[model samples]
Target: MRDWWRDLTDLVLPAECGGCGRPRTVLCARCRAALGGTGPCRVRPAPEPAGLPPVHAAARYADEVRATLLAHKERGALALSGPLGEALSGAVRAGLATVRAPGAGGGSVLLVPVPSARRAVRARGHDPVRRIAYAAAGELRRAGVPAHVLPALRQRRDVADQSELDARQRLANLAGALTVAPGCGRLLSAGRVVLVDDLMTTGASLAEAARAVRARSWADSPVRGAGSSISGPASVYGGETRERRGEQRNGPAQQWAGRRSGRPPVTAGADSADGVVDGMCAAVVAASPDAFEISRN
Candidate 1:
């Protein structure tokens, strides 16, 4: 009922620009341009965190882009999810195109979001990244892309707040801190896995999220209830061939049909059969400026 009221109230109230607090506008034209004026492009963090998948960001995190994300994430400006999500959707498309094989149909994409710490979520009143991912997934599906929001990873242990941590320290702090929710490996192997986040800094969180996806290579085969042969985007890296990769894709997961009943706040992705998760990609609404400079080389 609370969610219903929130929805109805938003319909009746005059919305404000989430980016600049402009009255009677959800997002001013200037703010919308900041979402992805140049469109989505590849980005790479320096000293790229290990296991970090190839990533694309819709816009560079600067000026209006930075301010927009701050307003939405820290100030609970829920309406900004629309524009921000459209940017992320564009980035997801670019990321898929970067790794797509010739003659491919661009199979369904399962957007797996990096999980937020429970305490931080409580303080923020919502999971910011996950919210954007869901909005992004909705944008893709509306555009005829088979995209679904699957938040499959969770924090395995508590870590200190990242506000003061250096890149190296953040990486170490997040190392071994994420894991796939049990019984979702079959789901992971069923589609192209795209990790989605609202922003990327040191890339540490995404790297750790990738590590959790890799760990699912060891998951027990899917239980009979949710049985379905896997189909996924081929990874060109790690030298894993289609036929060799196909053999391992046939079986994954434990009991997705039975075990996961908690809605989409749970679920996950990545193609890690045969001990290699390739062709994996990451997408974000925006990335740090240094990432753009690094991608050029």
Candidate 2:
């Protein structure tokens, strides 16, 4: 298989720091620090676009971080996933904190990665976002919190590449492009869903994905039995629900729907039997400098 061959090749290939040209290791310590520094920060592109979710980026896309992301995403530096995931885990935690709030239930965090285009997956030979999501989940579990990766979101229709478009154009291209997978509605009804991506550019993609998820959660479908109080369309997978904020011992319970002053209000749906219908936050492994700044040029 192609993956089998690629794995075998990686094991035998000479390793070098993906960020710098340093030899003998896939990533050197200094570069690793660069990738992990300052933890995560809230990132919003300048001239913020409509429907954009509050994104937490692990590091500013600069210097070694930029090189490392390109190496893994474009040059097939598969070994970089570990470090990249480590970096992204911080962002995931930050996003969760913002949404869940202090004293909120940490019960179980479900990471839902934004689906990559089939064409892009075929070209890359692997699904980078999913891989990183898995890594991030692993990191979370190791830290004692329950976590899982959910590839429940998918592209419903084909869209043009976003790289060439401006904010408005990008939003138009991604509009109606994503949907929850066949059974994801039930899964989401049961547990918390956090959209995960490798990078946040204009944030149009995350916003669209979140919108699709919200739509499916509200569809008047049959409710299936999952452990969670909220049930939705029947699914083979059982339901799960987030613990009440007051029930948690880790501090104050956080509400995902609260809007920070100066930030646009978070768009959410009417409350259902399950609970509040607030949308999930987005977590990115890294972001380009342009990610925080919209080009006015």
Candidate 1: residue 250 lDDT (0-100): 18
> How do the residues 1-297 of candidate 2 rate in per-residue lDDT, one tens digit apiece?
766777677679888899996998989999999888777877766444334445778887788888988888777788888899888888888766545321245346788899989999899888888888888889988987578998988887899988788765776687668888897776775555678998876666776776666556646234322233221222111111112221222211112222322222324322345533334667898776765443221
Candidate 2 structure, TM-score to reference: 0.77
Top model number, lDDT: 1
Against the reference, the lDDT scores of all candidates come to: 0.69, 0.67
For all predicted structures, in order, the TM-scores are 0.77, 0.77
Error of 1 at 274 (Å): 23
lDDT of 1: 0.69
